[model samples]
Target: MRFLQNLLSFKQPSVMRRIDIALIVAVIPHLPYLSGFILAFLFVSVIVIIYIKKVSKSLVNTFMVIGLLLIFISFYGELNYAGISRFSVFISLISAMLIYVVMLQRLSGRVNFYLLFSPALLLILSFFFYNTIPMLLYMIFAIFTFSTMLLWSVMEVNLGIVLKKSLSLFLLSLPIVLILFLLFPRVSFERASYGFTNDQMMRTSHDGTMSIGSDALLVPSQRIVMEILFDKKIPPASKLYFRGSTLYSKKAGVWKQIPQKMLHFKALQKRGEKTSYKVTLYPTFKKYIYTLDYSQRALEASKITDDHILLADKNTEKVKHYKATSYLDYINAEKLSAIKRESALDFNATDYPQLYTLAKALQDTSTNKSLLNLITYFKQSQLIYSLKPEIDENSPEESFLFKYKKGYCVHYASTFTLLSRALGIPSRVVTGYKSNREYVYKNYLIVRESDAHAWVELYLDGAWKRYDPTAYATSSDLLPKENQFLNDLSINYLYLKHIIENWVLEYTRDKQLNILKKLLEDSMFAFTFTFYVLSFIAIVLLAGLYFRRDKQVHPTQKIIDKLLKKLNKRGYKKDKDEDINTFLTAIDLAQIQEINTLYHKIRYARSSSTDEVKKLNKLIKGISSKNPKYP
Candidate 1:
């Protein structure tokens, strides 16, 4: 019981305990799958534990809990659609939080030992538990989180001392790191692409075949997946149709891509003035990339496939930044061949009976121009644009024509393509992201998956012309005009993600080498080397200063000083302030018995004399060695 009491009363406060709590708070944002309620309960319990143990008080705890809860709740809508992986993430977060708390309590108040080693321990344990997760990602999170904890611990222990030192070091290293990043020799090594592959597989738009049900629901995703930057000024919005795959054939209510072997790219007769632009694409895992009608020249990373469509070298997993130069006029001027024309017009009339009848009726009444006019007529009439359109049991196209006249970009684009094919006009569905009007940041345009769109490209008078029936159907929904607050927040978040992707994930060996080379060339090398040497010297100096501050005289020396002062006050004079060995020879054993004994021990003891020597030696020698008659 007494030991327990002492342990509880241990004067040193546990800095690790506080730090663990703080880390938990910081990590909650990343655990999207975890139920907010469960996390809320756990967080509250931790805060209560801290308060009960006198680590923190009620008010601060309440505010923290409330604030974190609000943040978690705000992301609930997104979480619902994010799928099961998010839930697994929450479980891992809970495990991490529990481990942090247990470890902190065990360490007590020894903050430095805990601060430096806890992360390493956590990283080891994380692997045992989260073996399924990628080690690289885990390492990244561990390094970042632990580094933050270390910084916090350093500040707490040494107050502002560590910060000042670190800042000085950072300033010295900054220029060197920058130079190395810039001037490093770059090699074009193949990089593994990253993005939502499952999202791509599930993506109906990428396949070019669109159903009213699936396509309608994807309209409001609003998550920007890629960004485009032009070397020159961005092209006009009307000319901006980032092309994916061209769906040349529709059979049995499905859109079909032209076989790669059958399709071929023809060189332009006279290449027009080429405009170069770079597209930083978010991975859809789909082969096709949207380019303006024809590309005269492409970067080494990209290839011109059939239909003048651009295909990346490999599937992308993340944001892929690649450059391409296109001759916009040459592509616009190319005539559609018979094979292309036949494929675009080849729709199975047997499968879509009503669509076939509609086409026949239009053809019977009017010419090719009238059939084109009919598309505008249908879009203008009663069709409404929406994210969630009413899905029916019958054929989706027939449903769109008869039932819910309302639909999204997919509905309009799909209907328009089918109608054009039925009217003997060569047309196909083009799928890719649409333009985002809001300028997100410098040299980047935010294109969200919700910006995923489908439009018809009709081969008109020997040239394929872009036609957006959905744009005509829903002009009001083109760009978000209202709800400026949400819009701004979303755009800002996307922009931050863009920067992280570009700066960190895309940071190559070339970039690192360049930074190092630049540092060498810049004379910053001298400054850096000098700074490191000075820093080492300063650390040693500070350590020496602290050591001196903590220094104390030995107990034996203190005792001797006190005895000498006492003897002087009593008028017992010693010749020259003699050393212990010389002074002991003259000191009378009978007088000042304890002092005489201490002096003998100091002069004769095998080991250096201390408080133990004074105490034990006086007991042994005072009675026997001192003559009591003189005292």
Candidate 2:
């Protein structure tokens, strides 16, 4: 029983408990928006503080400093993150700080009006990231919780009365909220409503850099990257490679593009049937465009580089709708430039002496060939393909080549490029998605982040050729055993997501304007205009009715409230729990003790005579408007 009481925070002040409830409700909506680490930290911190009963100020201060330092370090690390991403994180951190302060039991009794609204700001911030129907409903509930508690704290009312009043307030204002939403001007924001809704939604996978051997589990994202509409029958599964970027420079087990110099507007040589398609890319917070391998032409490209990578003028903070013609099989850079060749072949022999020696050992003596031998070696390497590969920091290629013989696409691609460069082949790493599901939707294809892959592009003989060592990986189990029920659920979810994105979240300013125009043109608009006029009349009548019987309340009470409001405006306000005499003296208004005495006497010392009333009124009126005046 004691544990249950503590768990429910029953010992806390009633107002404080209400505030806690409001704070928790406001924070719950941000779960999908916040990272797992921050969520876990917040959970443990709040639980520990709540259950410990007594928290030292020093301990709270220490944790506060630690949490702030963590936030500062994170902000410093992700300086290049999108502005919206940074702003959301800043708001989230501030919310955490407020939660800490509220849970500290420091203000359990003396409730401040500002304390109630602090959590309200969190609900507003959350809507900026996501406004799904469920989220909208949750936010509505959070608003009600805040309203009910705030009214209870200020008024001397029963729980039933408080709840009724709160509901009445919401019900009364909902019509106005609807009217505003219908007529208010809307604007486009959140080209990405969420950062990966940063790095958690999508990933750093499509970002310029790709690392081979990090000791982290490789979990795939189901977030749709792009939906493509093929002009004809979609290409074969083996040919559905949507290229993002070409990486040549390898440093510290990471592959990255060489210099911006490697990027150019020169076109690739055409050699096969071209498939034209329109790409509707979602927000990646990046500037690169994805297209089929060896694009013939990208209509929206600022530059179609020789590496077959497309560059856009601005980051994909907004949806990109463009068309491109591409060839699944094509020869690239038949006459590879000397500079490009050097970059592709650039590698430190000292770093991978083992890989270099192995490359030489694989050279066939009779045929004097290395390419076929390399292919055969990979086929016979018996390398298992698993997303959860063991880390090999010092020598990733060496470990994969001889010791562990286990890795995913990145490991295989990175190692293959290194070995190719060692064998005097001008080769580079390619990062993109190999979308091969039989999924289709009205002549369009949805490419998911799970299809993200890395392969090799080597300038051999006369042109660049494609090679995916992952295809030869002996054991590949990147997906789980087939679960028909689970797969059906996933498909339905994706379909619903697509529908919401098109009809609601992605409903743009133009769509809103079009809707407004249609409504205005309709005959029912006459009723809408009448309703607007009636709403105005209703507001004015309500205001008049409220003040109609103000004479019933004594003038003394009104004067006291007016004075309190003035004092509050000037930052000389008194606490609700403080006595008038104490509050007045604390603000150095001790010279006006007569007002406090008269206030008490007027209420407690029976009916005042007319003369006494006039004298008290005159003395109170004697106080100056600018500064206090004594009578």
Candidate 3:
């Protein structure tokens, strides 16, 4: 029974027990992918058990220690799996837990209510020292947690006067902080301090081939990969194309990018008008940047290779904004060089014998240009269009052509390019996102990964003309309006994520210095310094105000004053301006005798005394501590 009573004692609640409960809740969402939901249910069951068992103090303490060990173990496991050390996370958790335990144990019932909430105060300070969170988010979370703790302490400790005064001080400090944040001169260093590499790009889509016996296709990833921004009148959603790599070679049933080679644009000058736009591309974990055809000029610091595609020398870790100028009316008719043509048309005759025979039969029926005939046949065929394609166990290409006949842009473009090459037409596969969703604030079209597509570009009439074999294969409603809405939401999300990456994650010394230089040049540095000084002064003033208010007579002191007044009304009046001891001696004989012994005991005590003076203290103690007559 004594052990049970200790477990239920509010003054001595086990710190480890609280930590155990918190750890169990925090780790439930991070279980193995397959077991996550099951583990969550099991954690909930544990919570129920803890509640029902009414665990003893010793058991609670034991569980808390076990929980701390498990938390450390989990942190190490995360470090191992992530291939990065989480020493800071481990240290912060341990420090926070230790500080919490110490504060709870040593400070209970001794300090003012705010002082008893030292654990929360230390946690806020930890966030600042750790630098594990964004400054803005850290400040917000700190304020929120601190405010919540303050409110809870006020309710639990009945510190209404302190709460009111603290709240007033907080309200007075907000405007000053806001003013400082806005006016501060931001500085950057010459060298960039932070950057993201291509390794961070979250790859969500697979290449042409699919692995057997794996659940690769159904692996759901919610990561937003890229955001595109375009200037000027928004292009029709159908005409928006984010052009990427041109794959002209296939070996072992896998599409490979052809080596970069120049293609002459004979009718480049024919375009009376040109459209120049900027693309703020997110890192796609691939080198290629999608742009329209016949690109004549690229922005500074970007490389325009022979294929008229733009490539950035630096890996695009965040949203990379670049300008591309493309001709709207240029014709690409430089026929493929003999070597290139042969390579483009090259395919293993023995591997796909049936496909080759079918292509030859179709070739014999065409009287016009082989490329034109192929294009016409594909546009006029009964091949269905669908995102879901049936994979054949025996032969994928054969099944796609003869039986299933329905697939995405990849299937259509792959089949078309291969068959065109068989019919003596040099064709290449181009992969990129098609269509853009416009954002209101950016005033630019945003593209997404779901818009990833494949099409064919054939060498024709002295230039390469784009031919989307899947264009005709897809109906207008193939992508539902709802899908487009979701795509829009995804693009917006990516844009916000890009902003966070650029402004927070990739914020570096160079950027900071640049900002400082700009501020100095604009004569804003003086204003910033003044603002900061003024704000600091204001905070100091507000803090002083709060301290002064807190230093006033405590509630216990008020009760002592009331007791003195009551004694005076009962004819044991203190002399006007008399000292406390003199006032006690002046009381009537009966009253003096009643309170003198108690007053001596309280006044000359070696340790700290309660607010109650000796006379009232003895009476209250007798009634409350012994007889309980006050109740």
TM-scores, one per candidate: 0.55, 0.50, 0.54
Per-residue accuracy of model 3 over 538-620 as CA lDDT, tens digit each: 77777657654655443334434554665655655666787665775665455444555555554455442444454455453
For every model shown, the clashing-pair count is: 17, 4, 15
* Tens digits of lDDT, candidate 1, 441-542: 554566666667788888776667777888666333245466878878876766676566556555676556654566678787758855875676666556
Q: What is the lDDT of candidate 3?
A: 0.54
The number of the candidate with the highest lDDT is 2
Off by over 4 Å in 3: 1-141, 144-201, 205-223, 260-285, 288-305, 308-339, 347-369, 391-399, 436-446, 474-631
Please give the lDDT score at residue 482 for candidate 2.
Answer: 67
Q: How does model 3 score by TM-score?
A: 0.54
lDDT digits (tens) for residues 1-631 of candidate 2: 8775344322223766777778778877766655555565577677764776566668677766665655555455544557326776666666555554554433233457666675787787777666465665677788888887778777543455555556667666766766665567777732335432432243344788788767334687677788777888778788888888889887767778865543445556666788898776877878788888877554544676667678787777756667788877676765767777888989788888889788878766532278789888999989999887777789887898788888888888988888888888889888899977645544557887778899888876677889999999888756765687776666666656555555555566766677678767876885786687578758755754544433344446665665565566667768889976687656656535676677667745656554665666776666654664422
State model 1's lDDT: 0.58
lDDT of 2 at 457: 84
- For model 2, the stretches where C-alpha displacement exceeds 4 angstroms are 1-202, 215-217, 229-232, 262-265, 278-282, 298-302, 317-323, 348-350, 364-368, 438-444, 477-479, 503-631
What lDDT would each prediction earn against the true structure? 0.58, 0.70, 0.54
**Which 10 consecutive residues of model 2 have the lowest summed lDDT?**
4-13
User: Higher-lDDT candidate among 1 and 3?
Assistant: 1
